[model samples]
Target chain A: MLEVRDIHTYYGDSYILQGVSLRVEAGQVVALLGRNGAGKTTTINSIVGLVPPRRGEIVFKGETITRAPPHHIARLGMGLVPQGRRLFPNLTVEENITLAARTGNGSARWTLDAVYALFPRLKERAHNRASQLSGGEQQMVAIARALMTNPDLLLLDEPSEGLAPLLVREIGRVLADLKAQGLSFLLVEQNLHMATAVADWVYVMNKGQIVFEGTPQELLGNEEIKHRYLGV
Target chain B: METLIIQLLNGLVFSMLLFTMAAGLSLIFGQMDVINLAHGSFYLLGGYIGLTMVRRLGSFWLALVVAPLVVGALGLALEYFFLRRLYGRHRHLDQVLFTFGLALIAADLIRWNWGAYVESVPPPELLSGQIPVFTVQFPVYRLSLIAVGVTLALGLGLLLERTRIGAIIRAGVADAEMVSALGIDIHKVFAGVFALGVALAALAGVLGAPVLNLYPGLDFEILILTLVVVVVGGLGTLRGAFFGSLLIGMADTFGKAFLPEFALFLIFAVMAVVLLLRPSGLFGLEGT
Candidate 1:
């Protein structure tokens, strides 16, 4: 479980997250929906310690992790699939996945075999350079790289960005399967349909603040909230 | 043919020495993006340390081991105290200025301790004789230098390209933030690699002491040579450093043998042309 409490984050004097709060229980898939500049990435970044919150506390599995360094937080069982799929372009696919491979978190760990099983295409291109892979394949490698860490909680920032609609559906299905297997995710997305399809609880963010929190059906049913906040 | 062979051997000997120094400088440059102007100072300091150890212990082997370790410890302290603070906060000319200051101080310290007079260490008795090579004879120590340099090149190449830690370092070289996000303590890697880089430079300094003699201005002399080698090789990888050292070494050697007057100018001209053609240098990756 992860708890981010009223965290105000800033990039220099420009305030990004003005008192944002959220929570994800174990095994829950929480989606944050907003248009551009909604501070979704900043929230995930704050939690990951890349951009530490200017003022707030983040607790991961009952421990305060707001001020921990990014690497330390990652070592504490929190994984981040960062935006832009920052893969080592020159490293082979196998090297990319295994370079960050930590010992698994729980009893049933995610191994290279498990990740390969999830994305068979990755196994086929094991020796190819990461830059040679297609966007969808690169996205899969990103997810697999995170899973290699065996994180108790995974934060995905725009996993479906720049993907085809079919690829987006495939990503959603991959998340659905992972959710069934009891992986907690804090997903930041612009796609409402995909967000709703996979997320258990949805939070609508606007202007660096969380404005609405409800179930998937509740979020879809409320057109006023959707139109006003998420710009749907 | 005999004259050509002699010049080529001379070039190879000098190339090995330059490679030993440039390999470390290139790796440190790639990893930290810090132009450690003080790097050659490590060589000067290590030569003095080796001189002292060789005299007191009466063993070239012991001096060889001890001098680099002493210089490496000093380098580690320098990183922890001074250079460590500069990371992220200081990127450009400030780092150069700081390391440049260190180089100055190191030169002064060497002068103060060892005096301004040039000093030299004799090659070990076992390697003091000459060995026949084709038509001419070569000093056993010079051949030893070639052997040492070749072994180091292979060993370092394997360690960087084959191991998991090497994979992490190579990846970090490509993208640092992602490596950190993967739970790698990148700062530690920087420190470790920096230390190794300095240690190797010091080791080369100790090894080359007999070949080039020990002097206060030696730091500045080799610093220029190392910088030229790193630039000509490329910027990021060990392979680049090795090739760069060879190219520059051969150019300098043959240039000197045939055209002693214009050798330096010609070498610079060749280097400028190489950069103009391939800005990344031979075997170097882009973006430093």
Candidate 2:
């Protein structure tokens, strides 16, 4: 489980997350939805300790990690799939995935075989450079790279960005499957259908604050809240 | 024809020496994004240490092994205590200024300790003699430098491209943040890379001592040469550094042999041509 308590994050003097709070229980798929500049990525960054919050505390599994470095946070069983699918462009797909393979204290649930089984296309292009992959394939690589870390909690920032609608649906299905297998994740997204279809609890963000917290059906039912905050 | 062959052999020897020096500089830059202007100082320091080891222990081989270890330890300390503080995109100028200052201080200290006299280490007895190369007698030690350089190039290439740690370093070079986010301690990787880079420079210093003799201002001369190789090859890639060193080394050797007056100018000319054609050097990724 992960919890963020009223964290105020800033990029220099420009305040991004002003009093943002959220929580995700174990095995829950929590989606944070907002339009551009709604501070979704910043929230993920804050949680992963890329840009630590100046105020408030983040508790991951029981420990306070608001001021921890990104690597330390990662070692504590948290993986982040960043916004841009920042794969090492020159590295092969296998190298990219293998680079993130860590055998922490856990029994190592995710292996190269498991990742390849999840995305068979990646295996076909195992030796190909990351830059040579399609957007959807790169997204799969990004997700696979994170999963290789064997994270207890995965934080994804815009996993569906720039992918085709069909690819988005496929990603949504993958997330649903992963949730079924008991992986906790906080997904930041602009895609309403993907988020609603996959997420167990949805938190709609607006201006760096959580505006709505409800089930996916509740979020879809409330048209005013969806249109005002998420631009859905 | 004999003179041309001799010069070509000389160029090859010098090219290998330059490769040994440039490999470290390129890797350090590639991994940490820190332009260590003090690289040549590390080389000179290694040479001086090697000089002492060779003289005291009466063993060139011993110096070759010991100098890198000493310089590498110093590099590790420098990274941990000083270099780690100035790591960031906006703090690049600070890194340059700091390393430049270290170079100046090192130059003064080396002079203060070793004095301003030109000192050269004799090649080990086994590698001291000369062998015929196309009607010209080339020193065996110099010829051996080519082998050493090639072996080092292959070793470093394998280390960077094949191994797990190498994968991590390559990944770090591309996206350090993501590497760290994968539960890797990237700062340690940076520190290790810095040590390796400086150690290579030191190794080059000891290796080049016989042919390039240590004297006043040689650090800057070697520094400039290493910089040229790195820039001409492109930045942050081993292939770039290796090929760049060869190109610059040959150009300088041939230029000095034929047109001594314009020798330095010729190296820059090759660099200018390379840049004009491919701004990122031979193997550099775009926008790097």
Candidate 3:
């Protein structure tokens, strides 16, 4: 479980996240829906300590990690699938996964074998450089890489950004399967349909604050609110 | 024919020395993005330390082993005290200014301790004799220097290309923040790499002492030449360093043999041509 309470983050003099609060219970898929510049990516970044909140409290599991560095936060079981997938272009698929591997996550830890089983396309291209992989394959490698860290909470920033429709559906299936395996995910997405397909609890963010929190069904039934807040 | 053969051998020997001298400089710049203008000073310090060790222990082998460690420790100290604070500042000017100043202080210290004298330590006894190559005799010491440098280059090539740590270093070169995000202590990697670079510089000093000789102003000369090597080879690649050193070494050696008046200008001329042709040097990533 992760809880971010009333956090304000900034980039120099420009204020970004303004007193935003959200939470995800254990093993739940929490989709943060927002338009561009709505501070969804900034929210995830603040949680992972890439951009430390100017004033806020972030609790992971139980302990406060608001002031911890990014590496320390990563070590404490927060895996990030950065925007653009950010795979080391020069590294082979295996090398990219192994670099992010953290041992002793628990009995159900995700090993290279486990990840390879999940994404067989990556295994075929194990020796190939990440740059050689297609976009969908690169996104798979990114998720597998984060999984290799055996993180309790995975933060994804815009997973469906540049994917084809078929690939987006495939990614949704993967997330749904992972949720069934008791994994937690905080997905930052602009695609309303993909967010609704996988997420249990939906939170709509507007101008750096969470404006709506409801079940996916509740969100889908409401059109006026979606048109006003999400421009959908 | 004999003169040509002799010059060819000399050029090869000098090329290898240049490779060894420039390797560490290129590596530190590649990994930490630090110019380390004080690297030549580290080389001078190593030679002086090796000379002192040989005089005291009466053993060239022991001096070779011990001197680099002392110089490497000094390098570690430099990183810990000075360079550690400057990571991610995006201003390399501070590093250039600080290290250039350090090089000056190092020269004064050497002059104060060694009395401004030019000295050349004798090669180890096994390498003291001459070996006939083709139509001419070459000093065994120079031949050994080539062997040492080539062996080092091969070893370094393996280290960067094949191993896991090498993969990490290569990845770090591409994106250091991602490397840190993967839970790696990137600062530790930087410190160790800086120390390794320092050790290589000291090794060059100890091994090259007989060939290059030792003096206070030697630092500036070597530093400028090494800068030429890094710039001409490409700023952040081993291939650039190797090829750059090779070209400069051959040019310097052959220029002296055939046209003594143009020897000094030949190195810069080669650099000018390479830059005009490639802009990023011989091995630099294009448009980088």
Number of the top TM-score candidate: 2
lDDT of 1 by residue, A1-232 (tens): 9999999999988999999999999999999999889899999889988889979899999999998988999998888888888988878999999898988545538899999999999999999999899999999999999999999999999999999999999999999999999999999999999999999999999999999999999999999998898777
CAPRI tier of model 3:
medium
lDDT per residue as tens, model 2, B177-231: 7788788899999999999999999999999999999987988999999999999
lDDT of 2 by residue, A121-204 (tens): 999999999999999999999999999999999898999999998999889889988998999999999999888888999999
- Model 2: runs farther than 4 Å from truth? none
User: Residue A205 of candidate 2: its Cα lDDT?
Assistant: 88
Model with the higher TM-score, candidate 1 or 2:
2
Tens digits of per-residue lDDT, candidate 3, A75-94, equal: 88888998889888878999
Top candidate when judged by DockQ against the true structure: 2
DockQ, candidate 3, comes to 0.60
Best by lDDT: 2
Looking only at chain A, give the TM-score of model 3 against the true structure: 0.97
- Which of the CAPRI classes, incorrect, acceptable, medium or high, describes model 2? high
Runs in model 3 deviating more than 4 A are A105-108, B285-288
Candidate ranking under TM-score, highest first, comes to: 2, 1, 3
